[model samples]
Target: MTATSVGALLLCRADPEAVRPPAHLLRERMLLLPAGTGWSVLVPEGKPWRGEPHDGPDAAPAAPAAPGGAEPVDRVMGGWATALAVGATWPVIALWWDGDRSGYTLAAGFRRPVGYVWLADGTPAGEDEAMRTFAARLSLDPVLDVQELEALTRQDPEADADARLRELLAVLTRAGVALPPGLAPGEPADRLRTAAGVHPQVERIEWAGWRDAVQVELDAVESTGLGPWVRGPRARALAAAQVAAGIPLTLWGARRRGAGWLAAGLVLLVQGALGLAYDRFRAEAERGARGGGPVW
Candidate 1:
């Protein structure tokens, strides 16, 4: 009836697209297993899921498995990762073709079970009888039981949800990710700043903080070359104007105007070059973090 923490955590990945298996369905499947070690994953032989419009090789959902299909690589994936990723609702049984074949076995880390009918070798067996025994224990959720994902995705794209979504993304953006009104579609940022709005000062603070982060990121990019590509001419003009207005390098009389133009042009070019260098530097930094330094 109750799944352990890890089981629940992993199960939570299920999104509520009608085609995707519901969480309770997976739970019911797991409850049938007789206290065992090992985790679960999905695999496919020559065919795809029972009934599908597209029966092509990659059309049906399947999990990552070993050559002989014995050991599974990741536990988070069951049935087919593709199905879950695309929001299919079928309960995929992890099946292994057989041992002594040329492929390797998909093994698990012995994490808590969540209705995985172990694929001993590419075969789907009801040998794990506890699953059938607990079938009656499963209950269907009510319509109101819309999960968090459903709630998160329910609103119209151009509605408030999109705005909130933008702000949420804006909040989580890596420090230095810029957010001028140009990047986003609406003037919601300005509107949200008024004291009368439902979320007064919400977008205002977010925009302010976002701007600060953007500047830091820009400075880094300008020093290096990783700036974002913005579209609006107004935004670009504003940036250039800001550059031109700042203490101009003026000589005297006619030379003053020329000096301002020269200073602005140099600043613009320097800013652009820095952005290019930064993109390269940031990419390299990410690679180093993931690859654990150089190979050579």
Candidate 2:
């Protein structure tokens, strides 16, 4: 596959506001925009997989290189999808295509990701069970959606890999995914960014440092009426669990040099740390308001 043909899009089953915080945590420069009624899309501004320089308007100052030369678009995106979905309430689906193959990876909270691949010529290279799992996780219409998805897995001379992805998306339209114009499956990364960039409601996502991210996250939680759940023993236990899971996962990713796993581990660690700190600070503030020692 040629570098120019490599492209990907992240589809989150939530609105832009709900997606903004986690998108920031990915630390990649991206364009965020509404997809449809309840879906949001994130288009990366840099081509980390190809290690190609992006000259897009929202491009990062420097594109990150894959650990050992350029990584395949699907692998890189799968890792990113996992990282994004692990800490989110909704599922994330990453659609990626290199010149030779096109496929998708769907990730939900702590669940094994499921995907199906089609060769550039439209040959199916993945398992059938994956389609069923995909349908189930997305909560698509069990019979109708499952039938449509299953059909894609079978032979079809008319469908190339690109066409296959498009069909896949057609099925998702029933679930509220409406990708913006010019953001088709086979388009290159630059074009996808351009399309998303021009969107009226599009917002740029960048690394804003831990302090800001935590504050934003706290605000999101409170706005969602989850503040009470963010504290207390139950919250503490969940936080500890995340920390415990993160350390080894981080080491394992580092050892293997897998960016996706690495990102997932780091996210877990950050969320854990943020949860613990948020609980403590809130407790202190409440105590101070009750005439205990100053909150400082």
Candidate 3:
């Protein structure tokens, strides 16, 4: 699948404390746009997918974070459809950060399929609709045939591919879904099977929320650095993410809620353009404060 299939895009923040959604707010539609059939699954690192630093693994699959802060590591998250057969070869995965996990690899049946972003049927159920529906009930765990997927994660020395079949069989048994061995995984074991749907795009939006919060915090640190004309580590990092996403920082600025203290956008107006004006304004204000100049 195209790297763009599972693209991770982000915009910069002006206020570190400001709240915003990572994905564009559905200003119009109340549904999640189907991303596409190219399945892009990501396993984020760090505590609960907070935006991590610049130099690190992109997909660190550690436990969720606690109240205390810690550095986040990276892990892999994107890929596309593969044949359902037993042995699959290396699939193509595009990379943005530095690491081997950023690319694709040869794995088992569930390594990553071309994701179909829609309701179970062929219809567009945007993030909002998905979330609304999932909030009550959604299908995510359909007794996956894990033998192939587990094989991708590690070596399996089983005599039969039936191990996966057994796992799925066990899950169905527990869910009270009775079916014959002849039934396919996708074929409904029962009428209620299709009732539950998975909303991946909604999950991605939540992930973006965590990132937005992180960016807002980073924005505060960078804003302070800007006044001194130094490149704060966080600012440099934000710029790098922009570059990777193939979007201009300026467009992200447009997504900010309110301007800076001076009503400047996400990144303040470049000092090159506003520095002298700022200094002159500061001088006049200082002079007036000292009662040594006209208060124009």
TM-score of each: 0.19, 0.71, 0.17
Q: Give the Cα error of residue 9 in candidate 1, in Å.
A: 18
Best lDDT goes to which candidate? 2
Q: Which of 2 and 3 is ahead in TM-score? A: 2
lDDT of 3 by residue, 1-296 (tens): 11111212111111111212222121111112222232222212112222332232332344444355533222222221122112222232211221111211222344332211221121221233322222122132422423322322233444222232333234324323333222222222121112212432322223334434454344443355363433434434444443443233445545653233223332333532344444455457557858966433
Computed on alpha carbons, the lDDT of every model, listed in order, comes to 0.28, 0.87, 0.28
Clashes of 3: 23
* Model 3 residue 143 lDDT score: 29
Tally clashing residue pairs in candidate 2: 1
Q: Name the 10 consecutive residues with the lowest summed lDDT in model 1.
A: 1-10
Which run of 10 residues does model 2 get worst, by summed lDDT?
Answer: 51-60
| Candidate number achieving the greatest TM-score relative to the actual structure | 2
**What is candidate 1's lDDT per residue for 197-260, written digit by digit as tens?**
2321111111224434444344443332223442124335544554454334322323656755
